[model samples]
Target: MHDPGSSEHNNRIPKPLGEAFLSLLERDQRRMLRICTRLESIADGLPGSGKLRRTAREIAFLDRAFDRHMFIHEKFLFPLVRSLCDSRESVEPMLCQLEAEHATDQGLILEITAAYAGAIGSTPRAVGVPLCTLGYLLRAFFENFRRHAAWEKMLLHPVVKDQFISETPKHQHDAVLRYSIGAGRSGRWFPAVVG
Candidate 1:
């Protein structure tokens, strides 16, 4: 129910960092949601086991994008958030919850992937799973992922935007640089995705 754009404090994220990293993460989340929508439609239209491979393929694709998505969160955003917060205890619970959800998401995807492979070239009853059952799992994965991503956008994004420390523009820039993405890491800003 929370709105990501609503900020209670006057503090603002540095334009460069916000535009380059935060906004892109949000964009990625939206992209994932679109994928979820597609997956939901696939689930709805599934008529037989023949389409289960397509569901698996789409889930596999989503898993790749999700890896990059979680990399940004675990490597950059969460660390910056922890640093900016007045008390680590306050934010730790939320961070832990997100991390836990990440694990659950990965587990579900893995199960779906394995099931897809196991069911290949086999009948639905032989695999002990009906087409409708796989469809149910696909729907569940996307729905759960949708809720998780939305929660992150609603709770975390606004916190990052408004919780930063700054007095003047110089100080703001310093703060931004200190917590900027890819700091003290490889020159590569992002992992390359081979299309």
Candidate 2:
């Protein structure tokens, strides 16, 4: 068995897949940061800022993106981790919490969307509750998502790396081949060329 502590086993998703996944996550983080920063600016000032409509569109788009991202994790990453984890107990609760966050995010997005619309149509006082709620949720969502990504990096990645490393040389090579061919990115199918 390969040692979990081995540096070679410190990266999950194989090299190519991991790199791609990290890039995607980083891009998503940038989006979240932009949303968070935009949200923060409104908290201190009146929503009369001309940016409400644009920011509303971005938040709406993020709502859909979050759903798709969560679906990807649920369909691919989390299952892989669950199958490979040394103990399901160690990872299950975290997965559950993260999944639950998706629902919470949906609700927050609704509130934010409504707030944006209200602020645009009428006075800030008319939507004070939603405005306040939106500001709070933005900070909460960004921080929680940042921490969630960190947990995957620190905890799940190590476990996945260790599991991948534990495979026989042939299997590791096959995994790389499969991953490189887009198996990890999406459920694409072709005969896996095995030598």
Candidate 3:
């Protein structure tokens, strides 16, 4: 029942990264939830036979989405924040923690992918392994992303606005361009229908 493009679901625009990445994350998260829900439904329907191909395809798609999500956060968003945020004391540790989380995220995605593929080629009991792996990964992603977004909104954005006034004018303008380019190139993260 989640609407990926619904404005109500979109996160408020953080001045650092702009609203575009937040919108993209909202849309992508909804799409991922939809895919996971559909996969669960499909799995539920095939109780005994174990539809390997369908499960494999779903897992593959999820893997691709996770990859793009990580890339955007690590490569584009994090670097921008690091460059702009003047407080080395607070920002540095947070960025380090965020990077560590990203690594964990990648690990979880890889584990899910491997387990899902292995399950597809193995016995029925093995199917549960991937499902559980995906469930954990999804939960972790939701928790981490929500926390990260909140931190940016409440703490980071305000600091940037108040203390780092010098960057404000250029920040907003750059944020729009960066986000537009990032979103446009995120065709890999988006579903074919959205693309």
Instruction: Summarize candidate 1's per-residue lDDT along 30-144 as a digit string, tens digits.
Output: 8889888877887778755336556666877978988887887787677766655667688889998998988888887776665555446344534655566567777788989
Judged by TM-score, which candidate is best? 1
| Descending-TM-score candidate ranking | 1, 2, 3
For each candidate, what TM-score against the reference?
0.72, 0.60, 0.54
Write the residue-wise lDDT of candidate 2 on 64-120 in tens digits. Answer: 777767665665566655544557688788778767766676677666666666645
Give the worst 10-residue stretch by lDDT in candidate 1. 186-195
**Root-mean-square deviation of Cα positions for candidate 3 versus the true structure, in angstroms:** 10.8
Ranking by lDDT: 1, 2, 3
lDDT to native, each model: 0.68, 0.60, 0.55
lDDT minimum window of 10 residues, candidate 2: 186-195
Better of 1 and 3 by lDDT: 1
Compare the candidates by lDDT and give the number of the best one: 1
